[model samples]
Target chain A: MRQNIITRFVLISLAAGLLSACSPVRDIRFRAHYHDANDLLYAAAQESDLPYLKAHLKDGGIVLFSESWDVDMQKEIVTGDGQHFDFNRRFVRDGEMVVSVDSVVIFETNKMPKNNDQSRISSLSVLGGLNTALGIYCLAVPKACFGSCPTFYLDGDQEFHYARAEGFSNAIAPGLEYTDIDALNIYTTTGGTFPLTMKNEAYETHNVRSLKLLAVPREEDQRVYHTQDDKFYLARQRVELTSARSGNDDVTYLLNKDDQTEYFSLADPDNLRSTEEVFLQFDNPGNIQQLGLVAGFRQSLMTTYLLYNAFDHMGNLYGDLLATVSIAEDDAPTIADVLYEQLGGISAYLRNSHKNEWVYQGTWYETGPIAINHQLMLLDAAHPEEEIHIKLEMNRGMWRLDYLHLTEIIEKVVPLEIQAERVYANKKHDEDLLQIMLDGDAYLVSQPGDTYRFEFELPAIHDDYELFLSATGFYMVWGREEWQKEKDLYSLYMMRHHPGRYLKKHAQAYKEYEKVMEEAFWGSRVKHQIISGHDK
Target chain B: MINKQVLLVLLMLLLAVSCSVPRGLPAPEELPYETKGTAFYVKLHDGSVYRGELIAAENDALYVLPAENQHPNMKRQSGVVQIPWDAVDNYRVYYAHGKSLVWFVPVYTIVTFSHGWFAFLTMPFNLIATLTAHFTSQHEHVLRKKDIAPEELGLFARFPQGIPTDVALQDII
Candidate 1:
């Protein structure tokens, strides 16, 4: 249904554009002419020419006398009983005088032209009206538009879901800049060089300090995973779930594979912070010392909506709000901390049969709605005969879990950091950008439509390696003109100081924009042309 | 099933186009000439131009209530000026009546930003459209002397029957 509406809108806009281009304004000209003074006098004497004569006589510079006046065409003389004036229309004297017709340099008149330029007038009126309406619409609902930092894409990946990672989403200011690592999930590669395309597909400026790959070596069946604390782990011997149930519904099929079919639940309408749990039972790997529960998950639109709502509330004061966040004291909780506390991450627990209780392991979370991030939570040691039962608890409707499994941890490993050797901006090699990425001293500033390809030389052409993207940068969001009218400092303060209350109050408002926001967001994506000679 | 954004855009488009075309001026004969005063830009044979309201006209001369505030030289005199038919040149009568359409500049500029990266194209198009409309409307209203005759212009004056001889020139001025 949404697709149909979008198609219709496109068609209508195209038709309007084509019509405007084809239609030209009609021309209308109102002109008059005379061969000489005698012809003008003869034409002026006729009754049929009375309208033009009257018009000219009224304001067409045909001098009028307070007394009667007569023109003798045969004698070529004009007599008038009135005040005489010079050539500049200055009064000379009030007297009866006779003037020669030969002294009359010219006799002229005018007519109001009929306006046949209706097409141009109508076109302009329509265009102006449309522009004003759109402007007002933008002023009413600014949040329906989408904006974010630089988005990275792999070769051959199609649509929004396939986006590899978003750089420094939380860092809205320079003071909060930090490095972000995302697992590329590209376990195998045949080429010697790894090419990654980074695009600034938002109305924002990106100041990227560095871009590199974290390659971790693993065997055929082993996979590398990162924890919430940024620790890397190599896990092997995967064990699929024997059963998975969320509120009595078996969802094992949804969580068994990393096929992008995610399992999710709706948020509690009354309270957005309400939590839910899913129970999973996996076969116990006998005598396994280190067991890790790997889960592939991504955030739902709840976070996106909340973040965008906060920005909307800031409005024209967004710069002031961001400044406060950036210059916050060390002991004070920043915006990130406040948001994280409001929407808690996913917590896992192991069911202990001996103690007859569920023991909390750890919570893991990564921001972004595009990429499904997989993190491994180390589970406590369990008895071999006992079934490995795990409970995954998280904020309702805040997360979408795509995959879950139990794996035996081999050992902790540090990834090989690979720096880009060459950088191509818009299909042309850029040495300055490459040097900026390598030196890490300055930033490679990118505007709204910039596209850069980073090529990294791999250590070896082996297929037994996993690649992860480590990007460090910060971005500044462009303030919309519509937002300037909505500036409310008190609301911004409420959002920063009391997020829970803010979220509760804004729930209904967010609900109004949430339904179509995702579609609009993706639909407004910046079109990036594919650069040849890039590896997938 | 239509998206809210799409619906809003369509509604605005409809509203805009519906109100786009302004009402045309009344026909020449239908005009209320009794209370309507006619102003004109009169050019002399010596190239001096004067703008004022029409007072009266005779066979060989025209009586004009010169706009003293507009012309510095006319500021010294406060009464009507009479020009001989021999010293007269062409003149244009002012009749255009409408509000200034320059408000569209800011409106269109604001709307341009909503087009995302496509703003590059929309900005220039909006500016050109707005400027053209403004200048065109101004040009469409003024009646040029070459296109009209002085005899017909009397119908658009304050007294279509011709200025009353009993009225004082000072009262008319």
Candidate 2:
């Protein structure tokens, strides 16, 4: 009975299996979450929230963001593993639900432009606008510029240019010299109108109070010329080396280039006849040596004036004349002699008449506002106790003291004998101090009839240096009631673009430049650029 | 006669065939981004940035160069450039493996037809689009697998720096 029962059960089990196998199957599907991958991409586009979108993508997704501007994924797939997807291509399906990105084909087309050369990139959409010039600079800095750029103290010369590149860590080019006029890597801006600036190549700190757009270059790997002119109270001048030795010794300078021998002067009988060279002098006392120019004459003029810097399309600075008047050939100071030494000996009056009714001579001079306009300040990464450079700019109708500068030390102080590791404070990869450099300085010039106000928002006295404002205005202007309440606003940009640890002697010239430009543009619209220390 | 036994047998055969594929299509399961088309980034012998979209990436062996090929000071940033196979550091490319375009059809297309050849033809397009968008270059992203990741930079790499110091603002904290 047991055998019969076992046998019967086995037969029944076998029959059941065959029966189930022959039956038709209904459709079945697995549970899945709705994933609109496009939503993440769209979110990234809308908010520019790269990190969020990046979270969803894996493997090569990050690489795509750096790929061609034209993003597509339809016709075929060229993966990283040397494989190609052609028309009528066949692929096999595995039984696994897990998926992956095998590879990518980085096409050599339609990439985001790495440089913004306005001349070449007439197409505006992704171009870095002039608006971001300050904001981009803020990358290295924590704050935006306020009334003026702070005094950017430095360890070297001013009037230099440096190259910057995006996504590429090395923005600075390898070539120390600028090449390729077509690529055009250098740029400049004009402030007043006369003197054109030829930025020096030396490395130094700069106080960028104000900058006029000069030229936008096309190449990323090009050399830049550093400058020493205070971006604030800019005194624009041009340097043309007609004959480097013409105005220095027994040589004469003429207003019109066609008639080189037609200059007339009143300083000495031999002033025009004995010029050996013509040196260009600026009220802003920054280094002139590193500018990579042939020999020329230079000096500091006692007065303030107006001038703007303009470079050629190729980023070249040439001295241009604003106006000129004829004088006796022998009356002007010889070009060889320093300006301050012979300015007094040189008499000035209109060619037609004699009273103090005067026009500026075509000589190289720093020109800004009679009253100051901006105050920028910068600090050194090595030292803060020493005064470096003082620069200012002329704006509207007045001059603004750009800044008083001091060295910046990242570590503040280091033990003298200790072979200690260098401490780096400002560490943002995208940061370029040039993009958002700032400093501090005082301005005495206010727009006509209280349209504007001026005061020192920072302190400059370390008691180690004796800084004087006698030249700017011996008469102390009021609003003392406003001072204590706003210690951060009433300060001045003392020095900029120089070493701070040196004696106060270097800052003396910047102090005087402030005084003269104040008198030059007493009532123009010029105002000092002051960057509030407030960082948001 | 053809009662429950036949039904059971039929159901077993159908289920076995259906279970052959769970995900339906074969693809790279791990990649965040997929290639719709192939293109190249051209870094001229002279330092400049250039790129293209519908380019190819095959065995043409005409224009293939690494990224660190163009800059004199490549150590600082070290860029990548593409050059012609024959030309040393500057040239164009013609690849055997090429890129494809992604065509976009709206969701409204589904309502236009729900049956017949109209829906049938549209059905193929939808299938193709669904697959195409799945692996397109535009939709790809990075997925970190290794403990050590390669350094990545943002868009600022394209700009050059050249401002003079006198007027160059110096801000350090």
Candidate 3:
């Protein structure tokens, strides 16, 4: 009796497994839930309770509550591994919104393991060989394996794409068939647009049924680290360099002998004057505080200049003096000059005369490694997740770019040991405290409307050292209330980028730019001084 | 009588058909909302508020009968008020209306015909929904704020008062 009961239990289990193999969840409507409440939404959708539905969905939380545009899925699946679905057309209106996918394909092709009959024959003896033959027969013979393959055809086309399903922990019973959807590996490519198109690369045109649209709420924990702490943010990004504008004559990307990728210079080096722009596209381009560019090549006296402009996915530009970089024309050592001056030697005269000869007149061996950096606060305090588009315009692009580095803007404190004579604090007015900074860490503790001032005295400004500021609070120009953030402030005090000289000579233009920027956007603050000798 | 193998095959087919039936949106009566004479509190995007009794809600406009106690400032339109859908952000009703058991009979019948095999297997649970008009009741108001999320703030804008400090501030100094 016990044996009979065990046999009956096994038979029941087999019947249940066979039925589940063909079960399908059809036309499942994807309902968007607030990210905070998403933990409970999948369970609530299964019930018919009106109160739960209204609380979780119909209010401000769900995407359907707002107006939405319709998008249809691509009907035919491509037979190769590189087929792309076009979703950029539908998402052109609102590129910032989150995407919601409605349908997941059910019927899919199975990927079976390859068999080598010769290798298997040596391992199998009498009983093992018989078992292997029976297994092969069940898998190869369509009728023997039952209904678990990708042969389902609906309305002439296949019911779903052909791909192997992912294996879960539970084991399948004997004689039952299963399909894996993961082998299809469908993905959406945004191409700088919302609702990125889905690409399926499996070898077959799978059938598509229905799809719907919804928007997901912005995730609560989304954040980027500020580069102030010198934290490494560039390691997370994947870089792809291409021509700014689409054309056959644009920049060419090449892989060298060491497997390093770099942009190859044009065949005619003077072709750098052409209007072709080199574009650097970085993934997850949000909250980028500083972009560092280093060019490694063999140019000496020829200073190559690059102009970079930033835009968003929707083609909106950002920043006035966002960032600019240039390679210096000459790289010289001071010890050689000093030794030549003492000895009054031939090398000393050659160093003084020939240093700038190649820069103005031009020579062959003027190529070497040069590096420069530009810093700009790309995102406002409110919307930091905006993507950045970097357009590198080659004013003189004969050199090749090795790799570009991007850093986040977090906090780090570096003390500039400048002595100050006076430190003042005011509750109302903007004061200039450029005289007396004790070269020590200054502290500010006051109510919301209060301001503090300090001054630093230094050797006559020869522009030898770059200036940096570390502060815990920030203020808008002329005390604007709308640009106030209490207790969180960071600013970089460096020389402003002008064509020839710093902002000192171009004070009027710099002040006008500052006014426009204060009225429009915010960025790192800088102090201006008219330094001699380097003004040219 | 059918053989055991045939019986097993038939049972599997029934399961497949029952599982494939689609689940749809709930019927109107099954929704949790007040229907008639409900008082509404409407807040506009520009910080305006309206409180009155709802007379009729059309697709384009809502006709409020103007509760004498509520609208003290605005002039009424011939003893009735018409609020366009565009002007209002959203509104919340005060009370909950109870649905009757008769409203669920058609829904249950439709579900039964669609997935009769599954319905027979899960009849004990369906009994609770089919036997009552009000399966669940909630008096809470469904509220929606007309404010943009922090992620949508302008590039140069700052939150002066520091709205949500618990969430990290986006500070690009």
Candidate 4:
């Protein structure tokens, strides 16, 4: 019937539209943000011409204890069997002229890309002989190790305001009067917010504690996690903002070491960052505030060239574009005495390297890791059994954790997903086996095969220690190239139900492929140098 | 070996001929031709665009430094660069027979104003050298085989120029 034909046509068209809408023609031009977004790091051997030493932190790594804080990073990473890898050398073409580094990713750190949001900036007056710098804060991925970085207050003596409450309203704190009001702002290499703060501003008749400061989450808002026993449970500790709001009004939370629960935040618009301050505005209010800028005078050719181009002194060219904006403050905590509370620091750098998004795209190498794509990537390499700081600078209050790590029980646990545990232990052609355990039952996830999920609940076991599996090599995830943007709804990132071991055999060629992949990883940088040298 | 009078006459004649020849003039036999427009030289960071005869280059930061000196061999430079996107304006790739007044210095120095750091004491030396080169230098240059136009560059000739360059330049770079 014609009716049936029409119905079929409608369904096909709808499906086509949805698919097309999913992936728009992406236009990634070279902008200032690119200077920082290009975070693919390169640690070439200082003495060797190998280009890079490719190393990765294992699923469960050594327990590292911070002598200063008495905290353990290694212990935090260890789930079942601690694993780590360090590639001594990757490229041999440079005749030992270049050095390479093993990449180590600091897990569950600040990985949120820069985005748009309402920003709150501060103004601090200069005092003679004071060494002060603006902190960089990144709006964090909610519920991660660190919830988000705090945006720092900058230099000057003026009343600052921002939309911290549910809506926008103009506000200024007491005692911050300036003749010039030259909007002073904060800066950083990697921007973010602060963790703890105390402020001093003139108060009204009510008392000294009437002042409040407000900051907005720069990325996505936070999502709270709790334990079954009526306690907070999280993978990492964070500063959380809880609020009750009115029209164009915000409540600031101020911590009283005297009374912990009497916290109140101020939501004022005078604190809002405006063109009068940063001299830029968004076409849309939802865009992430462009508070931090990456200032690089030197960089690698490939990172720049691959993004768009590389200019020569003699090639004869001129033209440019720039975008700048202010960060918004969302959470407002009342400040009883202090006018502004500073959260963190800021900084920037150049990669001088390029990620070959084009070359390895859509190929077998594109999934980051074939069997299981790495939604999470760490950026440190040659990670020793020591606590390395995944430093962040921001301008907001730190993600506060009331009680923590209730869910983090296993000494070693595996990702429930990921098809192949294809690991190639390159340095030592030694025993190739993976360790695993589940519910006090010692079992191997795999020696060589596909990794499958199993539900194991043991009541009698208090703490399960070790289990084993076999892998010719290990697994990997790459950042360069357009690894699929956004995540698959069904993708397995973490163990959803309970934790267990997984094992699978990597094919022989997969090992070769890994070596070749490592070669490709470093080989591209070599080509960058060659093309760079002898510039016409 | 000839008489002194004959030698004097020869010397005067040679002087007259040398004076008659226009000094510091460009070569008429420049081998008139065009260049193939290939890769464009863009300032990093800022993303400024420019096109011209890639006469001489030195590395700096992430960009190539160009010299305005038409005499490619004499072009002395430092390896310094600025991301064009970081800067405010764009310059055109135009030079007549040689370098642009603007392009003569590396963009890095121009952008960062690092030349100011050379100090007032050293400025006189730099100024003197620049002036000396301009007055005493022979500026006309020959095009490289690669710079010749693959397509007819005749159309480029009609456009009003910004900083005229070697024949390889277009109106806007």
lDDT top scorer: 1
Candidate 1 global lDDT: 0.66
Error of 1 at A431 (Å): 1.0
**Candidate 4, after superposition: displacement of residue A195 in Å?**
26
Q: lDDT at A330 for candidate 4?
A: 37
Model 4 misplaced regions, further than 4 Å: A1-267, A271-536, B1-146, B150-173
Error of 4 at A284 (Å): 33
Point out the higher-scoring one by DockQ: 1 or 2. Answer: 1
Q: Residue-wise lDDT of candidate 3 within A1-536, one digit each (tens)?
A: 23224544753554344223212211102222223233333444454541122111111121111112222224321111111111110111312233232221111111111222222122212213323443343222211111111121112221112111211101111111121111111122111111111111111122111111111111122122222122222112322333222133233233111122334322112222222334443344444454332222221111211100011110111111111111223443222122122212100000112233211111111111111111112222222243333444332223333333333433332323333334444422223332212222332222322323333333343222222222221111111122222211111111112222221233343233322221111111111111111111
lDDT of 3 by residue, B29-120 (tens): 32222112334556666666776544445456655544565557777545556567678776654322322223443444344422211232
Give a tens-digit lDDT track for model 1, residues A499-525: 888778776665445434433433344
Report the C-alpha lDDT of model 2 over A102-171, residue by residue, as the tens digit: 2321111121211112211221111113213323322211111111111111122111111110010100
Tell me the deviation in Å of residue A283 in model 3.
39
Candidate that beats the other on TM-score, 1 or 3, i.e. the better one: 1
Q: Each model's TM-score, in the order given?
A: 0.56, 0.17, 0.17, 0.13
Model 4: DockQ score: 0.01
Ranking by lDDT: 1, 3, 2, 4
What's the CA error at residue A213 for candidate 2, in Å?
A: 34
Docking class of 4: incorrect
Which stretches of model 3 miss by more than 4 angstroms? A1-421, A425-452, A456-536, B1-33, B37-50, B57-63, B73-173
Candidate 1 vs candidate 4: the lDDT winner is: 1
Decide which is better by lDDT, 1 or 3: 1
